[model samples]
Target: MSGRRTTHEDAHDPAPTWTPRLGDLAHDSSADRTGVVVEVPGDGVFSYHLRPERGGADPEWTAPADGSTLSPADD
Candidate 1:
């Protein structure tokens, strides 16, 4: 077998287990912010588009789809 260790083996904590979907409320732990999933990355896209949940001044931002920092927002 290849000697290279996997990510889970090297990580001090387990990686997150969530994926964002269109219209789903998501939390960006890296940014410490929560927003609505406005758009999900498509064939050529590599990021997720999120908008403020309460129509605030925050501009829509894109988050990586790596599934390590985003999780479903708490209700």
Candidate 2:
């Protein structure tokens, strides 16, 4: 194989280096998951699986940061 690495799919690729109020997120409590776009990876992938915003807390009940997205609760 070539030295070049295969890139991650772009459709789901998250942008890197969010400038605070910079990242957009999707949450799935049912899936017990959350994610954020970060730049260090440079793969257009989430920096890491987002754990609860705080240790052992329910992030869903938490308020978002200023300018952060707050989708209408569908539950």
Candidate 3:
């Protein structure tokens, strides 16, 4: 086998150091939904999930991205 590692081999790597907390507001432009951080799976940053701000169905899991796209929603 080659000395270089493959993408699949990196899957087990640790998650980012930062994670969103519960009640934090997040915005997903692709979904056009601004939701509140409802759960953090403790697996990693990507495991963080959110719920719709207006209240509705269960929140969906989302990938962790730079905070530039997400900010605390106004009260």
Give the candidate number with the greatest TM-score: 1
If ranked by lDDT, best first, what sequence of candidates would result? 1, 3, 2
Give the per-residue lDDT digits (tens) of candidate 1, residues 1-75: 988677865667665577788899988988888999987878978889889888778888888867567889999
Give me the runs in candidate 1 sitting further than 4 Å from their true place: 1-16
For residue 30, give model 1's deviation from the true position in Å. Answer: 1.1
Q: Name the lDDT of candidate 2.
A: 0.36
Number of clashing pairs, model 1? 0
Pairwise TM-score winner, candidates 1 and 3: 1
- Once superposed on the true structure, which residue ranges of model 2 sit more than 4 Å away at CA? 1-25, 33-41, 44-48, 57-75
TM-score of each: 0.71, 0.21, 0.46
lDDT by residue (tens digit), candidate 2, 8-39: 67546554432322243545344445533222
Q: Which stretches of candidate 3 lie over 4 Å from their true place?
A: 1-19, 41-46, 57-59, 65-69
Q: Relative to the true structure, how large is the alpha-carbon lDDT of every model? A: 0.83, 0.36, 0.64
Per-residue alpha-carbon lDDT of candidate 3 for residues 1-75, written as tens digits (9 for 90 to 100) = 878765875777755544467888876555666888876656565455678787877556564544434555556
lDDT (Cα) of model 1: 0.83
Q: After superposition, how far is residue 38 of candidate 3 from its true place, in Å?
A: 0.9
Candidate 1 — worst ten consecutive residues by lDDT sum? 8-17
